[model samples]
Target chain A: MNERSLSTTTRATVPIHRRATLWDRLLEPVLGVNACFIYVFLYMPIVVLIAFSFSASPFSAVWGGFSIDWYIQLFQDSEIARALRNTLIVASFSMLFATIIGTMTALALSKFQFRGRNAFETTLNLPIVIPDIVQGISLLMFLVLVVHLALGLPTIIIAHTVFNISYVAVIVRARLHGFDRRLEEAAMDLGATEWQTFWKITFPLIWPGILSGALLAFTLSLDEFVVTFFVTGPGATTLPIQVYSMVKRGVTPEINALATLMLVASILLVTLSILLQRRRSS
Target chain B: MEKQRERGQLALLLLPSTLWLGLFFLAPLGIILVISLVQRGGPVAWQLDGSAYVRLLDPLHLKIFLRSLTLAVLTTFVCLLVGYPLAYYIAQRPPRLRHLLHFFVLLPLWANSLVLTYAWMVLLRPEGFFDSLLHALGFAEPISLLYTPTAVVIGLVYWYLPFMVYPLYGSIEKFDFTLIEAAHDLGATRFQAFRKVLLPLTMPGVMAGSLLVFISALGTFVVPALLGGDKTLMWGNLIQQRFLSTPQDWPLGAALSLAMMLFMSVGIWFYFRVNRESA
Candidate 1:
């Protein structure tokens, strides 16, 4: 889900053949139409949700008159605010810890050939393919049976950091792979120590990756629900938890407003990540 | 002295994550394996036992497991069917438009699955967007599509199409179209060229995308919890129910978690094996 990972892969990509074959000419329009329909299928639900957020009446199937009443209600709701605050608290801390730890891991993997490198790489990737249920339930069981930590914000932070570290490492590792290492070599050859070389040459070059990784880590921590749901204690409900509870009651226009707001925030963060990706490549 | 200094720097670079993942990630999973083997007697006491995993053979639990598999398979194939063409289209576009289209495909993912599933509920509910549209198109009745197995599949596909598209596009973009051209130049039929050349070359991506989409859709909680009614329980919801809800069957839940992990390990191992073989 990290845009940096997706867009970075496009940097050195080759474009397709331009000369149209007769077969292509016959097939292209059909495929293009199907693609357009697929895009609509993907996006139509979201557009409807946003439009309905402005509905004057709650839970009405008909087009209720447009109004900002739901927005006003959303802002005034303290529980929602508390949940948002909790989400931010967890996301910020998770981002900070995951970034520092993950960037170091990425540096180690990229800069040195180590024993058990492949094993460590696979270990780090467990989060990517492993189900959230495993991560969440295992963490919960660990906290309860062994660590005896409260199922509160701290536990949530731990769970998020565990997964976020891998994502951050992957992003930073991708960046490290794409970056030129000769600059660091040049710095070291000029009588700079390894430490100085890293600070002067390596860190600056990979800083964008680190920043984007941090952003992705933050965004992922925000977006997570399953693991957070399991580990979160009472009084520490995150926004997704709050949304789930509200949704269980019924889909109110208030949730529509909240989903819209969160999505807009996601768009802005994604735009920032893509911008950071551009900066990294340039 | 230089070698020692380099070693120290490497240690500094590696120790934090090594310890963090070791203690937090690996250790917790290890603990789950242990917990799954133990019997929960009192609130705080557990005895070494292996019966919990046996309970995983319960018909209800087995049904959920099968349902999870069925939904995941459907989601993966549907995503591949839809996403392959989209990825192909994006890959064939001019560079500027390709980026824009790629950005759009990733946009829904960025918006998060929870929100999108909610949107799906809104659209699929009785007299909702789909129903209204169908009515306007001359259908006389409202059909409730939400809270069904079909709705669950739709939700999974909606959220996970990006996972399929990303890997597929990666492969498709790297493919050499000239080989296909050569096939045509040599008088191979279009179908023949596509089957022999393009499909074989892009097979890795297809497999990669399917596995990515499958693994995710298999373990998804949100899509099932909201869109899949109580009748349509899945592995994720089962795990949640056992741990967080009335059951609180820690051992059984842990066993289920371990089972899910086992499934993922096989998928991931296969995934790496595929990539390694292709490379």
Candidate 2:
């Protein structure tokens, strides 16, 4: 073990010696420039959008003086408000439904050893790999024809639930995979009922995963467009669909402000969830 | 008695998700498959026919299919090329810096894709930010970057890079760096050590990342619609227009969607087969 450690330590030091080679010096500037270019490529557009959100120009490209009029106008637009309301409603229900179903699926799959279990697991993940458009169109056709369901919030919720289920299931399943099943067995041996064991033991242990999954589902539903676009009826337009239409017509400052706000909110929520997950794991 | 109840409870737990997916996902996909085979304009309008399949064989439809396939393949290739190095660099970093690097990578994913596309449009349009920057730099004419195939490819690459990076990062993080050191100690050069030890070890992550990006890019609608504009006609946009618009050509739309589904299913089937065999 000493010899192995010595040899490995010496070998690792080789890269340090080679770092000052001629080729390394030549490539150092090139690498720096490349990194700069990639950074600019990634961020310039976002900066532009944020900057132009305050532009007084109705058109995005032409920059007139800055004003918050579009932001004010956005507030007064009833359609936008209605769309926002619809989106929140759909997202809330979808997130709630997906979290419950996904948590159940995760618990069942992780705890059980039934035949065709792999097939079930694969099927659960299939919707995520399938193209959203295909899934959306297919769901639209099914609801209209086979199920005879109306095209509105219910349809959007169901469609969103399809994607959200897989996401939540995967995350919660991952958490369960690392879980100590012995804890549940111990709780049961201690005379706790199954419900009591789950609520007091399992649920508390996996609550972070459940919360993260819910947040993910919520974010996905909030930003969902293609599926929502297909299934939504006239008055069921969500924020993303509304933003898409506004862009297709032409770019405007209001969209930038809307997008920026969404960006901040999503980032904050996801960050919080990730931190919660880390804390739980640690 | 306790074990039996536990089994029963487990079954009950699975019932809800299974029933929901059976009713929603599996059933809907089945409906799409059936719809794909049917022809429009019959007395029983939505009745089964082979005309949709026939329409799928048309040159235009075939072209769209090929275009989508090519775009997906190219996007996967670019993402792998770009993401691998970044993942490697992040993996090589000190543990303290690794989390920060990963945060930067994941930042884009947290933001909405549609919003990202719009940001790209604002930056890349002829008279937009890029043009203004270039003109200020003394370029006479504005560069026409928007509504082009290149822009579409850029958008695809940008949006999907993090997806590729994370999986690769996961694999790289798990890799035993001592293997590379062992190779080096055995008189291998730096390049040889990396080529033989590091490369082969990270192959699974590379494959997973590439497969995920390629499959997702194949069906991408938002990027092409927003960035490529009307000039480029990806299958996603085509399917949407056909089904959702006034023409309401359900048969053609279903055919197109089914074709995309079939194409991706084959790709995924092949990917899993290869991955399983390799594993």
Candidate 3:
């Protein structure tokens, strides 16, 4: 390590021209322009969507006086209300289950060197890599055929949890990587039991991870379409499914308003999660 | 006794989740594989038949598979082309500002894909923003970009760009800029230095991001449905139609799923092989 360090230090000390060459000068502005273009590409649709949401025009393209009518209309729509309720219910329950299960899995994987550890790890991670369409169909078949379970809200929750578990576990496990085991060991060496030590010490340390993971799960389940679409029965329409059906019908300003609101909610939650993770690390 | 108790505790901790995954997650995949092999006459009637795999060989189904593959490949390529420069630009930013920049990159990713697709629909459909803009710019006809394969690819590339950016950012963030300077000191051209040093170091990210985009793009359902419409049918739409709509062929759906899964497995195997060789 010191040998490599010596070479690096010497290299650092060497006098090298720090002036921008022609290529650097040429490339910097080009990269800047490209970055600006990419940002526009990323954000223009969202800006336009939000802009059109407040447009009084029924058509997305037609501009008219700004109004809150579409948002008010969304509130009056009974289908929208039902879909919102269903989405919240699914998100909350799925978040809770996924967080608990994933936290437990993360703790076990990080703390133990047990038999089947590799197998268990791989099994947990499989859902992340498996295509959502495949997972959706597979669960649909199993629920309908093998298990003969009803296609309803519960099935949707379970389907969402399938992917959510892996996501939460991965996030929590990443947070656990830098955890110090000695604190738990020391607590145990004292009068504290393993359970006591875990609750008082480890739980607080990993709480940020758990919170962010839960938030992520909640958002994912809320936005989940394909899997929920597969497993859902009639009258169990979540917001995405509702939105999808409405899109199939035709274009509407109400959808623009609804999409804008959903976008805001997701961005807020994701920002909160990021802040939580950052605060924990700092 | 204490060691045994500890072992038991470990088992207890792992059991519930392991069982949940095994029963609900792994079991469903197994069921799909088994269903793929069996023949389904109706909802109730079933018999073992391998003809589903053979039926996938027909020209129409094969075209669907090829179309999905082509779209996914195109999406991955376009994402890489668009994302790499952005990743590099962000990676070159000051360390203090990197997280904020990364947050911006991840913002859209965390947004619902459905909502984003709807936004794209607003932009690309007939008389939509894109068409209107083109018409204002002296285009004679309404631009029919939406409900086409190109629209599907655009939507996919947009959806998956952040996935590519994050991994490439991870790789580029850790890259030592001094190495490129050293190559420059040794009289190498800027392009040569980037090609020799930066590219090699970041290959892992490129491959990982490409695979992530490719797999998702291949299996995406909603984008094609909303953007590609009925004509630009992909493997995912075909499978969805088979299961949920006309002909309600479960075995065929399963077979198509298995075929996709098999292709993914091979891709993953090849990924690991390359990774190992590189290591």
Which candidate leads the pack in DockQ? 3
* lDDT per residue as tens, model 3, A64-122: 77999999999999999999999999999999999998998899889888877888888
Top TM-score prediction, candidate number: 3
lDDT of 2 at B100: 85
> Which tens-of-lDDT digit does each residue in A1-282 have in candidate 1?
434444454332222443445765567787789789989988888788888888775444567798999999999999999999999999999999999999989988988887788998989988776788788877777787777888899989988999999999998998898878888888878999877987888888889999999998898888888889889999999998899899999878899999988878877887787688668455
Q: Each candidate's interface RMSD, rounded to one decimal?
A: 5.9, 4.1, 4.7
Ranking by DockQ: 3, 1, 2
Off by over 4 Å in 2: A1-21, A26-33, A55-66, B1-4, B42-47, B176-194, B246-248
TM-score of each: 0.91, 0.91, 0.94
Clashing pairs in 2: none
Checking candidate 3 for backbone clashes, the offending pairs are none
lDDT of 3 at A191: 83
Which 10 successive residues of model 2 chain A have the least lDDT summed?
A: A1-10
Chain B TM-score for all candidates, comma-separated: 0.93, 0.91, 0.95
